[model samples]
Target chain A: MAAPILVFGHKNPDNDAISAAVGYAYLKNELAKRAGSDAVYEACRLGGLPPETEWILGENGIEAPRLIESLSEGQQVILVDHNETLQSADGLDAAEIVEIVDHHRLGGLVTAQPLRFNAKPVGSTAAIVAREFEIEGVELPRGIAALLLGAMLTDTVIMKSPTTTDFDRDIIARTAAAVGVDPVEYGMSIFKCRSNPAELPVDKLVNADAKEFELSNGNKVYIGQYETVDLQAVLGREAEIREAIKGLVADKGYQFVLFFATDILAEGSQFICEGDTDFVNRAFDIDCTGKSVWMPGVLSRKKQVAAPILAL
Target chain B: MAAPILVFGHKNPDNDAISAAVGYAYLKNELAKRAGSDAVYEACRLGGLPPETEWILGENGIEAPRLIESLSEGQQVILVDHNETLQSADGLDAAEIVEIVDHHRLGGLVTAQPLRFNAKPVGSTAAIVAREFEIEGVELPRGIAALLLGAMLTDTVIMKSPTTTDFDRDIIARTAAAVGVDPVEYGMSIFKCRSNPAELPVDKLVNADAKEFELSNGNKVYIGQYETVDLQAVLGREAEIREAIKGLVADKGYQFVLFFATDILAEGSQFICEGDTDFVNRAFDIDCTGKSVWMPGVLSRKKQVAAPILAL
Candidate 1:
C-alpha cells in the first residue's frame, strides 16, 4: 500500500468534522482502488475522545483511529473540518499535509497545502466531503451517504444555520432522495427533540459550554449560547438557570455575564445579563431593555454578529 | 425473494426518526440474511422531506422515502421516530404501522404492534436504533453507523438535549468510533453547525414546524422554537425575525405569538414576542421587561415550560 494515508480531523473533532474526515478518506480510498493505486486510508483522532464520540465509534463498528497526540513521522496527513488558527495543525512538515477540507472561515497558514483543499463556510465538513464524492464520480455507498447527511444535519442545524447555502440545500435534496429519507419531517423531528427541556440539569443547561474572553481592562466576561426550538418554553427553566448562574458567577469570580436567547425561527437574539449591565451593553454595543436586548436578523454570531461586536 | 418490507417514518421524519426506520430495516434484512430468510427492507417518508434529511440519505447512498399522503391498502409499513399522535405524528396510521420505534413522549394512541414497539425518551431515535443493533446482535454496516450517528447528533442537539441518556451517550460513543469518528469533536461540531444563524430563513428560524394550542382562558397562543450554539452572536438578526413573525402573524391572523430564544449554554430562554405580550406574561406567569423576557433554566417548552404555564 502506498504509504498509509493518515486521514485525521482537527484537535477537537465534532460529528460532521470527524465523519467528514473518515468519509472522505473512505471516498479517496475508493477512488484510489478504481485507479489501481495502492494507498491505505486510516482515520484517527488527535485529542481525547469524549463519551459521545466513543458511543458513535462503537455503534459504527469502526475502531477508534488509535488516538495519537500528533501526526506520526512520515505519515501523509489530511486535515478535515478546521482551520489552522482555531487549532494548531502546524506540526506537519510541508509534504505531510496533503489535503485539507474544512467549512469554517479560511484563516492564514492553511494556504500552503499541496494536494487538495476544499473549504467553504457553507455548513458542515460533510458537505465538503459530499462534494468530493461528486467530483470523484463515485457512487456513495450507504455508509458514506449517511455520514454526509449526518455532517449536514449537525452543521446546518437541519438547515436552521445561516451558513446553509442553496448549493447545500441542493446537495441535501439529492442526497436525501438517494438515501430514502424525508427532508421536511427530518427537520421537524430535530426541532421536536430540541423542544423539551424538563429533563436537563440547571447548571448543565446554563454552563453547557459557556465561552469567556479576557478584556483589555483585565476584566473577564463570559457569553453562553443556547439553541432550542422554543425560547418561551425554556422560560420554565429560567429561575433555576438564573440561580445557578448567579452562584457560578460568584464562585468563578467573573466580572460580567451574558446569555443569548436565540430564536432561529424569528432570526433574532435576546441578550440576557447579570452584573454591570452597562459594561455588558458597551461591550456588545447594544441597548438593553433591562431584561433583554433585542437583536433582529442576526443569526450568524461568528460572521454577521460576533465579528461586528468584537470589532466595536 | 419476499417482498421488500416497506418502512415509513412518522410524518415529518427527522434524522433520528428516518435513520431509525432505515437503519432498523437494514438490520432486519441483515438478520434475515443470516437466518436464511428472504426478507428485504425499504425505507419511506410520510411527508415532504427536509434539507438535511436529503444529505443524510445521500451520504448513506440510500434514496429518500416515498411520501405517504394516503397509504394504499395492502402496503406494509413500519413507523419510526414518532408515536401516533395528531400532536406530532398526525396521519401515520396503525393498521399499516407494523413496527413502532421512537423516543418522544407517549402519545394518545398505543402501538397496536406493541411487540415491535421500541419507545423510549433516549433523546434520539438513533439511540433506539443503536440499541436495536445491540439487541438483535446485528453488526451495523458503516452506512448504518452513519445513520445512527446522524440520528443521535440531531435528536440530542449534539448531546445538549435533556432527553439524552447514558445509553444514548454510550451508543453515540461506540457508533462514532466504529465509523472512525471522534466523539468530542462530533458533539461540539454538531453544536457549532447548529449555531450558524445566517443559513436559516427568518420564517423557518422562528416558526418552522412550530406548535400552538388554546389556553383555558379561551386564548389561542403559538410558540416557536429555534436552537443554536451561538445565541448571543445571532442576536443581530432579532429585528428581521421579529418583523417576519409580525408579517406571519398578520398573514396567518394568529391571536398571540411567542418565540423562544433558548441559550443552550446559559440554560435559559430570552423570550420575544409581537402579539399579546400579556399572553406571554400570563403563559409564563412572569413579568415582561421588553419586547423580550429573560427566562432562566428553561430548555423545553412542551414539558418543562409551556405545559406548566398554560395550565395556569
Candidate 2:
C-alpha cells in the first residue's frame, strides 16, 4: 500500500480536534476504497488527548489516534478543526496539505496548488465531517457516529453555544438519534468524565486546550479554556494556573497567556491572565490582571475569548 | 433592512469569475429568504466583464453585475472564483469577507471570524456553485443554469483541461442537460464570442484574465492567460504584447510577467514571457526568453502554467 496520509487536528487538542480528525480520516478512507484508489488515511494527534476524547474513544471501542510531533518534508496531511500554521503541526510548513476541514477563522495560510478546503461557520468541525459522510453517500458506522456526536455536543456545550447554528442543530439532532442518546445528557457525561482540575499537572491544566494566535501586530498570544461542571475546583487552583501560564509567557516570549475555565452548568467562564493584559482588558472592558474575572454566558473561546482580543 | 452584502469575483474578471459570483449571490439570497433573514446579496464584478460573460448575461436577459473599484471599510463581502487580496478589489484589506466560494489555491488570507469557505479542486468555481444549489434545495433558474453551465464548459475547456475532475465532469454533464445544449458546441460558442485578440489593444490583450501572484521569495509576478480558438492571431502581435507586459514589469515592479495564449481547438498554449524568465525556464525546461514557445496538451493555466512556476 502507498504511504498513509496523516490526518490530524491542532496542537493542544480538545475533544473536537481529535474527533474531527478521526471522523474525517475514516470518511476519506471509505471514499478512497469506493473510488478504487490505494490511498490510505491514518488519524493522528499532535498532543495529549483531552480526557473527554479519551472517554469517547474508549466508549466507542476505537483506538486513540497515534501521536506525532513533526512531519517529513512532502508528507501529505489533512488538517481538521484548525488551519493556522502556528496552531498546526511543528513542520506543517514543509508538509503537503491535501485537504482541510475546519471551523475556525482563516489564519493567513498560503498554498501553491489548489486543494479541497471544506469549512463552515458552524458549531463544530465534526458536524461538517458528518455532513460530508452523508453527501458522499458513505455509511457512517455506529462507532464513528457516536464518537463524532460526542464531539459535537461538547464543542457546542450541548447546543447552548452561540456558535451553534441551524446546521449544527440539525446535524446534532440527527447524529444524536443515530447514536441513541440524549445530547444534553451525553454532553454532561463527557464533561463530567474530564480529569479533576485540581489534580492535573499545572502545565497540563493551563495548556490542555490552549491555542496560540498571532495578533494583527504580529505578536503571539496564547488562550486556553478548561470546561468543567464544578467551577470551584478549577477556581481554587487559580494561583497555580496563572503561575504556569506566566512561565509560558517568560519562556516563549508570548505577549500574554489568558487561561479561562468554563463552567458548563453555570454557562460562564473565569479568566486568568499572565503577561501583558492590555488586549484582554480592552477587548472585554474588564480587569483580569493578577486575578480571575467571571464573564457570564461566555462559553465559546473562539467567539467570546479569542475574537475580541484579536480584534484589538 | 441591513445593507446588502456585495459578492464579487477577482480583478481581471473571466467568464468563470463573473458567472460564479452571480450564481453564488443568487443562491445566498435564496438561502437567506428561506431562513427569513433580512440580509440581501448583490452581485458585483471587480473588473471589466469578459465578452463571453457579457454575451451570456445579455442572452439570458440578466443584467451585468455592477462594477466596483474599491470597498468601504467594514463592508461585508463574499469572494468568489479567487481569494488572494492582490487579485481582489481595492481596499479589500479593510472590508469584511463573510464567505468565499473558490477553486484556486489558498492565498494567505486571514480573517478574524470564521466563514463559509466552500472550495474544491475542481474544474471551475461554477461547478461548486451548481452543486450548492442542489445541496441547498434551491431552484436553479434556467437562465442562471445556462450562465453557470457556459462558465463550467469554458473554464474546463469543454472538459479537456487537466484541471477538469470527475466532480466537474458530473456537474457539467448534468448542467449541460439542463441547459439543453451540447457541452462542446456551447463551449466553442463562448470561446468564439471572445474579442479577437489580433484586433484588441495590446494592453487589454495582455492584462485581461490576468492575476498577480506572490512568489515564495516575497516578490510579486503577473501571470496572464488568453484562451482563444485562433492562436496565430495572438502570436502574430508578439512585439506589441511584449511591450505592454514589459511596461507592467517596470511600472508595477513585478519580478516577471508570463503571458500565455491557449488554443482551445489545438489543446495547446504559446507562452510569451517578459521580465525574469528563470523560474519559467526551470519549471518547463524550455527557453522562451526572447521567442514564443508552444506547449502541447497544456490548456489550463492554473495547472500547466502557474502551478509549475509557483512550485519553484
Candidate 3:
C-alpha cells in the first residue's frame, strides 16, 4: 500500500473542519483506490471536540477520528482550517506537514518549507478543498457535497460575507445545486433548525464569539463580540453583560478581558474592557485612566482593531 | 402598557432559535422603551431545550424559557422558528399566533388560521426577525446583532442554499458590515469554528439529517441523508452504512427507513433502504426487491425528493 495521507483539522477542530478533513480524506482514498496507488487516507483531530459537534456527529452516524494531538515523525500531515501555529501544534513533527488548506488568518506556525499549502481568505477550508476536488475532476459523493456545501455556505454567511468571492459564490451555487438543495431554501432550513432556545445559559452568551490571543508577554487575553441592532439596548443589559464578562475573567484567569458592543445599525463599536492602561494605550492609541473604556470605530478587531493594538 | 409580544421558538430549541427569540425580544423592548412605551416582551420556547443548546445558553448568561409543551388559550404568541403545530406545540394558544416568521414550509398548524405570518422561504427565522428589526427601525445591539447574524449565517449555510434571496444577502451584508465584521472574514471565522469533529459518533453521521413524516395509517417513516463524495471507493463501508441505518430503524422503531446517497458530480440520488415493501413503494416510485434505488434529480427530502414521494 502507498504511504497514508494523514489529514487533521485545526487545533480547535470544529464540525466543518473535522468533517471536511474526513470527507476530503475519504475522497482522496477513493482516488488512491481507483488509481491503484499505494495510499491510505485517515482523518485526525488535534483538539477535543466541541459539545454541539459531538452531538451532531453522533446523530449523523459518523465515527470520530482517532485523536492525534500532534504530528508524528515521518507522518505526512495535512492541515485543515488552521494556519500552522507552532505553539498549538507543539511536539508535532514539522517536516511531516506536507499540505495545508485553511480559511483562517495566517498565524506563525508554518515553517518555510516546500508544501502544497492553499490558504484562501474565504469562509471555509472546506470550500478550498471543494475547489480542489472540482479542479482535480474528482467526483463528489452526496455526503461529501453536503458537508462541503454546508461548510461553504456557513463560512460565506450565504455569500453575504465580505470575504465571499465570485469564485466562492460560483462554487457554492454549483455545490448546492448539485446536492439538490434549493441553496436558498436549504440555507433557510438550517437557520430555522438553529433558532430553538430553551435551557440556554448566560455565560454562553459571553463565550459565543470568544477568542484568545497571546500577548507579547505571553499572557492570554480574551476578546469576544456581542452584536446587536441597538447600542442602548445592549447598554441596558450592560450590568448583566459586564457581570458575565467579569465572571469569565475570573474563571479563565486572563490578564485582559474585552467585549465589543457593536451596533449593527450605527456601524460602530463600544469597547467594554478591563486591562492594563499602557497595553490599552498602545493597542488602541487612546489614553484612558480607568479599568473601563468605551470607544467608537473599533468595530473590527481583525483588520481594523486587533492588529493595530497588537502592533502597539 | 402596550400588549406583551409573546415570543416562542421551535420544538427542541437550538442555539440560533433561542438566541434569535431572546435577542429580538430585547431589540423590540429597546425600541418600545425608547418610545417611552412599556411593551412587555416575554421569550418562550415551543418545547424543551436540546442538550447542546442548553450548554450554549448557559455559557452565554441567558436563561432558557419555560417549556411550552404546546400552545394554550389567551396568550398572544409570535412564532419564531416553528409553524403552528398542535402536536408540536401541545398546550399553547393557537389563537394568539398573531405573527409567524419562519424558514420552513408552511405546515397545517399555522395555515388553518389566518394570521400575520411571514414565511418567505428564507434560510433562517433569525433572518426574518432581523428584517423585523430593520423594518421597525429598531437598532441592533452587538449581542442581538451577533446572535441574529450567527443564526442567519449558520442556517443559510453562508448563503449557499437556494432559498436565499436578495433580502437575505442585503441583511447579511448590512449586518456583517454594521457589526464591524469583514463579512468575509467573520463568515470565514464562523465556518472555521465549525470544523472540529473529534467528539462525533458514528451514529450521528446517519441521524444528523434524519426527518420523519407520518403516513396516513399513523405509521411514521424516517428518511436520513448519509452523504459522501465516493461510495464505491470504500466498498466495504457501504455495508456499515446500511447496518447503521438498520440499527437506527430497530432502535427508533420507525415504520421504515430510507437513506439518500447523493452523487454531487453525477447529480443523482441513490436510495439505500431497510424498510418494508409498502412504505418503500409509496415513498419511492420503484420496486424494492433487495436492490438499491437509483433516482435522477432527487436530493432534499424536505423539498425536491420527499414532497413528490409523500404526495404519491
Clashing pairs in 2: none
Kindly list the per-residue Cα lDDT of model 3 for residues A1-312, writing each as its tens digit: 667777877555545567678777877787777778787888877666544445445544677777876554566766777543532355554436656666554344423232344555555677778876875578987766776776665444455544566667778888888888876666444433431222225455455445676665767777766444345755665567677877766877777777776554455667776654466566666664233456654444444445455544
Provide the RMSD of all predictions against the true structure, rounded to 1 decimal: 26.0, 1.2, 27.4
* DockQ result, candidate 2: 0.89
Predicted structure 3, TM vs. truth: 0.41
Q: Each model's number of backbone clashes?
A: 114, 0, 117
Share of native interface contacts present in candidate 3:
0.00
- Candidate 2 stretches with Cα past 4 Å from truth are none
After TM-score superposition, what is the CA distance of residue B309 in candidate 1 from its true location, in Å? 5.2
What interface root-mean-square deviation (Å) does model 2 yield? Answer: 0.7
Candidate with top TM-score is 2
Individual DockQ of the candidates?
0.01, 0.89, 0.01
Query: B1-312 in candidate 1: lDDT tens per residue?
Result: 776667766554445656777787787778778878777878766555555556656867976665656555545566676553443343444334555566543333432111234555466777877876876578888877876797787666666666667777888888998988886665555555442566677766776435555554756667776666678755778788778777756776666677777777776777777765676677677765246667776766555555564545
CAPRI accuracy category, model 2 = high
For model 2, how does the per-residue alpha-carbon lDDT over A145-262 read when each residue is reduced to its tens digit? Answer: 9999999998999898899999999998999898899888888898889889888888888888999999878999999998888889988888788778889999999999999998
lDDT, candidates in the order shown = 0.63, 0.92, 0.60
- TM for every model, in the order presented, reads 0.43, 0.98, 0.41
How does the DockQ of candidate 1 come out?
0.01
lDDT of 2: 0.92
TM-score of chain B of each: 0.76, 0.98, 0.68
